[model samples]
Target chain A: EPEVTQTPSHQVTQMGQEVILRCVPISNHLYFYWYRQILGQKVEFLVSFYNNEISEKSEIFDDQFSVERPDGSNFTLKIRSTKLEDSAMYFCARQGGTEAFFGQGTRLTVV
Target chain B: SQQGEEDPQALSIQEGENATMNCSYKTSINNLQWYRQNSGRGLVHLILIRSNEREKHSGRLRVTLDTSKKSSSLLITASRAADTASYFCATARTNAGKSTFGDGTTLTVKP
Candidate 1:
């Protein structure tokens, strides 16, 4: 079965640096999303992208966060300035209607 | 903020026993999905129930959705030691395609 794939399974970045998490969603899927889960916390929605544009974003998705579908197959989430609190497991998901698939996730660690 | 909250954060049961986890959400949703995660691996989609559907089943997994109450439940019957994992409920709202996942229920099936 086809699945979502994420690059850089684990990343360590300095505080105030920028980090880009990349994902390649299922080829035929139309909608893409980014979510993060802090240690011992629930998964929080960051943003949704469709038609190469942001469809919706949560409050947690502030000025520092941005998502881009730079190519037909790549969906990337960029954090302008990484903070310690931003360290978490970031998952990229794609949906074909109701059913969705998630990538293995990129573990971001900022120190 | 539209995330579901799961009850009984952790559970332990013997092999062949049934494990039930409950999730409650705060907003209207288009569908509810259940996923299982084994340690640091990616999430595996188990089942999805539409808002109009009351219940759905797949093999040993059964899911029920109560849109009016904004709650859902997942029951894994005849669970085996391999079934030990963290189960999470994710909600997809009608307005956007993003999914917000719950804290998850950690289930340990002892052999």
Candidate 2:
């Protein structure tokens, strides 16, 4: 089955550094989203993108975060000046008139 | 505030036993989806039931949604050791396709 794919399953970066997480959604998906889960916590919505622009975002998706559909197939989330609290598993998902399919996730660790 | 909340943070059962987890959401939704995740791993989509649908089944997974009650239940029948994972319920409030997820219930099936 087609699936959403994310790169760098594990990422370790230093505080105050920048990181970009990449995802390639299913070929025909029209909606894309970014979510995060802190260790042993709930999965929280960060942002949703459609029509090449962000449709909605949560408070957690503040000035430090940005999402882009840089191409037809690639969607990316960038965090500027990462903080220790930013450490979490970031998931990419896409919807094609069905349930959203999630990527393997990128575990971001900020030290 | 979180949109969905699931009960019984964790469950343990023997192989062949059925496991049921319940999720409650605070607002109207277009659909509710269930996902599974292994320890420190990515999420796997399990099943989705539209708000207008009462129940849906996929393999050993059964999902029931009650729009009036704003609650949903996921039942894994005759579960196996391989079924051990964290199960989460996510709600899509509109066709916009963004989803809000619950904390998830961790299931441990002993072989």
Candidate 3:
């Protein structure tokens, strides 16, 4: 089975600071996604990237948020000027057929 | 719009019993997927049922989809304490559409 790994299992960032969460797939995989779940809340879609470009993004994904594969091997989500409300578990998923394989997630605590 | 919503926000059952979770969506979907999240961990794909398929099974997990009703059900038989987690249902409108996840059902199985 293919694997997806996320770095910094837990991160505490000050509000208004910038943070980047990274996801590394087992190989040069396609169809990357970013989702988030606030404590005790639903898992919300942030964005999806297919091929080499972003295919779609949710309204919640404002200008403060951006997804990039700067190294072609690591997919990253950067939050600029993060807010307290951005505190959540951010997950990176890979598209596999009709299902998705997810990483352990990066728990972002914007204090 | 919120696409998927699960019923019975929480459930508690004894080990060896079967636990069922239902999910309803508001729009057309190409596939519905079930995922399990243990505590604060990332999601684990449980099963996927395409719109053209009625049911799918993997291990002790069984998922049934009813497109006419825009609903799906996930059944875990002979459950164990390890099965206690939040189960979420997600819908994808197209093969490449971003998945919309539901609030999820918190299942607690006592051993």
DockQ for the candidates, in order: 0.69, 0.82, 0.84
The CAPRI class of candidate 3 is high
Candidate 1 error regions (>4 Å): B1-3
lDDT of 2 by residue, B71-101 (tens): 9999999999999999999999886568889
lDDT of 3 by residue, B1-111 (tens): 478999889999999999999999999999999999999888988888899999999999999999999999999999999999999999999886789999999999999
Model 3, residue pairs in steric clash: none
Q: Which pairs clash in model 1? A: none
Error of 3 at A51 (Å): 2.3
Residues A1-111, candidate 1, lDDT per residue (tens digit)?
Answer: 448999899999999999999998867667899989887777788998888888889999999999998878899999988999999999999886688888999999999
Q: Show the lowest summed lDDT stretch of 10 residues, model 2 chain A.
A: A24-33
Candidates ranked by DockQ, best first?
3, 2, 1
Predicted complex 2: CAPRI docking category: high
| Candidate 2 error regions (>4 Å) | none
lDDT of 1: 0.90
Each candidate's fnat = 0.77, 0.85, 0.82
lDDT (tens digit, per residue) of candidate 3 on A15-111: 9999999999876668999999999999999999988798899999999999999888899999999999999999998887767888999999999
